[model samples]
Target chain A: MVLFPGSNCEHDVVAAIEGLGGTAELVWHGDRSLHGVDVVVLPGGFAHGDYLRPGAIARFSPVMAAVTDHAAAGGVVIGICNGFQVLAEAGLLPGALQKNRGLKFLCRTVELRVETARSALTTEVPVGTILHVPINHFEGNYTCSPETLAELRADERVVFRYVDNPNGSIDDIAGICSTGRNVVGLMPHPERACDELTGSADGRPLLRSLLTAGLATRPA
Target chain B: MKFPVLVEVKLREGIADPQGATIERALPALGFAGVEGVRVGKAIRFMVEAPDETAARALVTKLCERFLTNPVIEDADITVG
Candidate 1:
């Protein structure tokens, strides 16, 4: 896991992953290497105080160089919420996360339908499976050029779609994967919903799927 | 030399800006009529340690495009002095 200065969700993600029998550690943004980690997670938060824009400054962090290298090698990278913005700014993902359509900071649980089972993040999730996850953001509305949207669809990059269209994202896109299916970015916080005590356990399957993916790539 | 630069980023035309519209709607009720085409944007001011104005402008434009603004949904207006 990568921890940008303002990141508050690293521990949450760590706990979730650890609870699922996965060893996770935080890699500071100032660091310039992944140290041979298989999965790099960019947890959600107001990185670099969200100055200029969300993920704008964090995208230039030294660790990102290693992240790009890792992803290019087909390593799995998951960016959640503000992490998603970082991925977009880093050019690892297409489209931009602009202000929500209603211009309000939305914090609520939303239904997300698994769109593609091809990506590492959704491989264990059956297509059309609905997961109730919580999203908290002011700039979570995803927008892209028409051509990019067409490409995303044609390439099977979209992985999740909102069931009720909470933030007015184009095509109700809630999450998407990279062309290689190794990188996934989403607005919802799966970590927050991983336990039943938190009101929902829909996130379990997603995290388990990631764990399954990681195990597959584990060196023999 | 140090040059001052201003970069304004606004949502491209045809993109809905509910924040601007909400403010515009509030203006009419506050007796400020005839307000139309309200759009919200971000203004960024910074100083660049470039050798010349042209260099500063070029640097600032690059910054605007690469980081200060997301060209996918925004248009940037940059000025250097």
Candidate 2:
């Protein structure tokens, strides 16, 4: 996990991974190396106080060069919420997240239907599976060019779709992956929903899938 | 020489501007009718050390394209003095 100064969900993701019996560690944003971690996760938060834009400043962090290299090498990269914004800003993802259509910071559980089971985050989950996940963001409306949208759909890169449009994202897309299917970005925070005590554990399948993928790729 | 640069960033045409729309919707109630296309944007002001106005403008444009604005969904109007 890459930890920016303002990252707030590093511990949540750490706890969720540990709860599932997986080891997770934080790599500071100033560090230029990932230390050979199998999976790179950019956890959610208002990094750099969301200055200029949600993820604009954070994208230039030194650790991102390593993160970008990891993704290019076919390693798994999962970006949740603010992490998703950073991914988009860094050009790892194709779209940009703008202000919500309602212009309100939404904090609630939303139903997300798995659109494809081919990506690192959804490999174990069946397509069409509905997961109740929580999304908390002020600027989560995803927008992209028509050409890019067409390409994403054609490549089966869209991993999740909102069961009901919540933030007016184009085509109700809740999450998408790179053409390689190795890098994934989503506005909803699966880490926050991994425990039953937190209202729903529907996120376990997704996180577990990530862990499984990471373990499979771990160097011997 | 140092120049003052201003960059106004606005959402690209066809992209939804919720903050702008909300403010536009509330304008009529305030007796300010006939207001249309009340798009909201931000202006960034900074000083850049450059040789001339053209260089300053070029530098600011580069910043806008790479950092000041997200070309995916925004346009930046830059002014240098």
Candidate 3:
């Protein structure tokens, strides 16, 4: 996973991945190569200090260009919170993140409904299964056009929907899959809510769910 | 080279745009009700051709995702002519 300079959640995400017995390496955002890594995770945090928009500046980082190339090559990219913002800014995903509708910084643990079990991840859960995850952000709303929304629905790319919807999201969307489904960006902090010590283990499956899918896209 | 491009952006809706409505209401008070459809919006302009359509679409979408619009509170669309 690439760590942006201001990423507050990198260590936490590392701990969560480590605690889950998953191997994770933190690569600085400026690194130019994936170093043979099969998947790249963009951990949540205030990249470029969240200046001029949550991740507008971070999208242009030296590492983002490499990340974009990797994602285009079918490498898996998972972004959470500010990471999601960076992905949107880098055009890895669709939509943008903005200040909350109420214009307040929101911090809470919320429930999310699994929209598809067939996705690269979340295949272990049944559709509609709920999981608890934490979210912290001023701009985490998921917005997209009605036409794009329709295309996503028709393509079944909606991966997760917030059950509690801590923030206002179009169609209650909490997570989405890329056109290839291997790339996913979600607002909820699954890494932060992945432990029993965190008082909830609901975020556990998301990390491990796709471990068996074979990292990266299968040979064509 | 003057060419057509599609720019997508979003502004707050009636309930969400306090800035826009403030401007609208103040217009009437300032004797500018002539601007009844006073709503705030964003403009994105670019250039493209048939061969450039796919690249243009992708690039414009990237621009929308990156800068031209915010994905959460704001919505976006593209026009090509």
Best by DockQ: 2
For residues A36-137, what per-residue lDDT tens digits would candidate 1 score against the true structure?
777889999899999988998999999999999888878889999999999999999999898898888999999999999998888888999999999999
Q: Give the TM-score of candidate 3.
A: 0.76
DockQ values per model:
0.83, 0.94, 0.23
lDDT of 3: 0.76
Worst 10 residues of 1 chain B by lDDT: B63-72
The candidate, 2 or 3, that scores higher on DockQ is 2
What is the interface RMSD, in angstroms, for predicted model 1?
1.0
lDDT of each: 0.91, 0.93, 0.76
The predicted structure with the larger TM-score, 2 or 3, is 2
TM-score of each: 0.96, 0.98, 0.76
Instruction: Chain A only: list TM-scores of all candidates.
Output: 0.98, 0.98, 0.94
lDDT of 2 at B70: 97
Docking class of 1: high
lDDT of 3 by residue, A149-181 (tens): 999899889999987666677889988888988
Worst 10 residues of 1 chain A by lDDT: A211-220
Which of candidates 2 and 3 is the stronger one according to lDDT?
A: 2
Q: Is candidate 1 or 3 superior in TM-score?
A: 1
